[model samples]
Target: MTQPASTRRLAVITGASSGIGEAFARAYAKQGVDLCLVARRLDRLEALALELAQQHGIEAFAVQADLSKPDATDRIVTALAEQARSCDILINNAGYSLPQTFLATKAQQQTDFVAVLVTSVVSLTHALLPGMVQRGYGRIINVASMVAFSSGAAGHTLYPAAKSFVVKMTQSLAAEVADKGVLVTAICPGQTESDFAKANGTDQLVAKSNLYKQTAEDVVAIAMSANEAGREVVVPGWPNKLAVAFMKILPDSWTAALIRPQAKKFALPDPTA
Candidate 1:
């Protein structure tokens, strides 16, 4: 049987089937927080929910929805209402990058990317934040990336723009809810050990690189700690922190000149090829 929402804290984690989202689910479950795991992969989500619930003795359930759909947020909200649960913590972590140039990909694909990376975030947050604010307690963690600070890159053109939006949105929301006991944070992680590369078909390229990579667990741990401490933005690891620092210190033109060539390697091959 499920417990009343007032008695136990419930956290809604998007993209909770794997990677950083899964890490967050496990971390919060260990702390006795009931979980509503959101992901498009029903099998993985169900398996994870069952494992966590059994291991931690917490109420855990999976909600399968593709965030690219505009109605996805509404469905999640409705599910929570059906369960008589209100979100105490929300993790807006669902995202992916298109590895092609703007002209190389279909316009529909671009819109879908925006839907998942930007619109879903804003919609979900908007829906759940009211309940959180009214209860005078909430935690919102928006997973931006270290690229959020970059001026522009050749491939994954929209990724940085979307992440930048998340960072700015987090800051503004944090300011507004500072006195309301709701904590909003944007966690900016660099290259992480996750399926992100594989999902975008860059696994080989990423694996060949010698760049420092943080594990999903490490990223989640830092993000949780930072949110609890009322931090508005955090870069998880020292290497990522240093990188972000340089991006901020260097002139935009200089950074763009340095980043473009490197980023081009990850762009998708020409369709005509």
Candidate 2:
């Protein structure tokens, strides 16, 4: 039994201040879904919220909180309760990569990545899943990366591992919730034109790879379509899909040998250099 779109179609989007997150917010707003936008930058979130509301005539509420914090999920749940809203869609899109190699990066930084990339997502999904299950309609889009399908290169050990977890979890959860009318999908986008490049100090690399890069809007469109169709995982671009497919058939030993020589190309430069 499908419910009316106006009944309980509010969406909760984390990392909604910029980049792919903001793109998802705008996409959902364009579909007339009310939004609860979460991000650390209160000003940006507020401004985006206002803009979306005016431009799309959809309700947009900004919740300012760092997803890296341990209590972030609780805070979000509390805010939603206060508003008498329950989440119909959850876009767990908040994450950032540490620049240094696994050994060189601070232990605390690694822990914080786990908190934001893995724990926060699990917690928020747990908090929101019950209402969605009861209502018998929901959508969850976990923003992973194309790297999720392949082994790490350079200083990106935890990123691929965490994203791999998201992809696997989405698969399992899709199986569990399929009969309940809820869809879970992992959106794996390749190099994208977003603030990610600026934050990681890879703007030059990104600019050089413009021919292979995807726009945030294009990625969001693919993700939304995947979610609607209950796709377990989606790799956005044709090149990325081809690359991942090739990697899948390649032997691990050969893949590792090939990647080792090319690893330095993706390595981050020393901040002090």
Specify the highest-TM-score model's number: 1
Error of 1 at 66 (Å): 0.8
Residue runs of model 2 more than 4 Å from their true location after superposition:
1-8, 270-273
Candidate 1 local lDDT, 167-221, one digit each (tens): 9999999999989999999999999888898999988888877888999999999
Root-mean-square deviation per candidate: 1.5, 3.7
Per-residue lDDT of candidate 2, residues 31-125 (tens digit): 98999999899999999999999998888899988878988998899999877789999999988887567777778889989999999989999
Per-residue error (Å), model 1, residue 88 = 0.2
Candidate 1 has a TM-score of 0.97
Q: Which residue pairs in candidate 1 collide?
A: none
For lDDT, the strongest prediction is 1
Once superposed on the true structure, which residue ranges of model 1 sit more than 4 Å away at CA? 1-6
Q: What C-alpha lDDT do the candidate models reach, one value each?
A: 0.92, 0.86
lDDT of 2 at 152: 67
lDDT of 2 at 85: 84
